[model samples]
Target: MVADKSPKAGVQSVERTFELLEIIASVGGSAALGVLAEHSDLPLPTIHRLLRTLSAMGYVRQLPNKHYALGPKLIRLGESAARLIGSWSQQHLRELVERTGESANMAVMDSDMAVYVAQVPSPHSMRMFTEVGRRVHLHSTGVGKALLMQLPNDAISALVSRTGLPAATENTLTTPDALLRDIDLSRGRGYAVDEGEQEIGVRCFAVPVPDAPTLTAISISGPAARVTLKSATKVAPLLKRIAREVASEFDEHAAG
Candidate 1:
């Protein structure tokens, strides 16, 4: 028989293409050819070939400054993907809202910030409300911190340096050291909290969606008067459990 050419041969190339795309995204959506080579640990020639193909496919663009950036075509795909995630998240948010008597929200990382994609408002008139599509800093909000929890310390530091950790309230962590400490505590507790950081009188509890298709988080927010420290202890476990369920359902749907 002649030399065989299996689809497996193509799979490796496809995987490499996606890997390069991820590397570009990881480095803030733009990378010089040398930077790409260094980060990917792939040969310059391989990077060039893959980037060329991606450029032709309109998934990557070569900048005037000789860096490669995520192309405009990706925005459409990303928006569509976010919409799907938001749709799937609605029922989970509803459950959290019903059980916790607070507004339940789902957010995903976007443009280096966490943006709300779905929300189920509380029945009570006094509940907190963060509109869907509102972008909040990763250092100043419960859902934002939860979204960042899984990233490496180096990545988190880099993100903070880029975003500058602007304070939204007196309680917001404005230093990397403080934010890291808070992240450590959040990790230990298996949840994150926003105590008047995003909004005065509002307290939020959030958990990262484990094994999610994207960096995603879900949260419940209410008046700080109603959502006390004692109640946070009770709400955190439920937030974590529901987050896992949301991730499971999302991953199942993605695989199918």
Candidate 2:
């Protein structure tokens, strides 16, 4: 399908505003309003008005130097969008939650941590706890391992050097060699399993979110009583299928 053309009615203002944001992003961070106006081919008055409106809406930020950049609202909006698309994984996560009665989540690597972009909560009284922006170390979580498998050995080594294998729990991998071995095993198995690594008694089964430019992963998690090796064996294929579907959705969205 053809993508929607920009500057639709009533959103011409938004289009112009994003145009300025594009200019700033193109400049590799921030830009003066005059340069933005020139780049967007809009009049100074119009650019100022659109920018003012965007700033008020929190989509554009004004730096101390009077330059404009994308704001926190962009992250908020992107998260909202991620959730919408993440709903594709919801059917699977919900099923996993229902079958295992545990919390299920889909996360992506953002710098050094795994951020929960989407989640399906268990209805049980004792459930795994997590939120959208919840970030956890790469070496300590199942979702992190799933995503880390996508990186090359050299890159993984670099990340290990940068983050250091800090143990979240006694069960957590505290050495680069151990973590590397786990990553390799996860890649070989086409899934990653966390056994009381991130938290005591919490187990997770994870698969990589495919078709992304960078690493992204999703997992179903719960207490060890419910999310055992046998349970993960049952859920692995399902999680991989859902992750692939979500990845395709993301690919299409990015292409559009």
Compared with the true structure, the alpha-carbon lDDT of candidate 1 equals 0.89
Candidate 1 residues lying further than 4 Å off, grouped into runs, are 1-10
Model 1 pairs in collision = none
**TM-score between candidate 1 and the true structure:** 0.92
lDDT of 1 at 173: 86
lDDT of each: 0.89, 0.79
Q: Candidate 2 has what TM-score?
A: 0.68
Q: Number of clashes in every candidate structure?
A: 0, 0
Question: lDDT at 98 for candidate 1?
Answer: 84
Shift of residue 167 alpha carbon in model 1, Å:
1.6
Model 1, residue 163: distance off in Å is: 1.1
How many steric overlaps does candidate 2 have?
0
Residue-level lDDT tens digits of model 1 in 37-134: 88879899999999998899899999999999999889899888888899988888899988889999999997589989899999998888878878
Model 2 lDDT tens row, 1-256: 7767765435677677666776765454567977886788888989888888888988888999898878887777667766675676677677767766778888876655678877889897777889887888888899999878888877788778777888878999998888899999999989998889989999988888777744678788888887788876678888887777777777776778
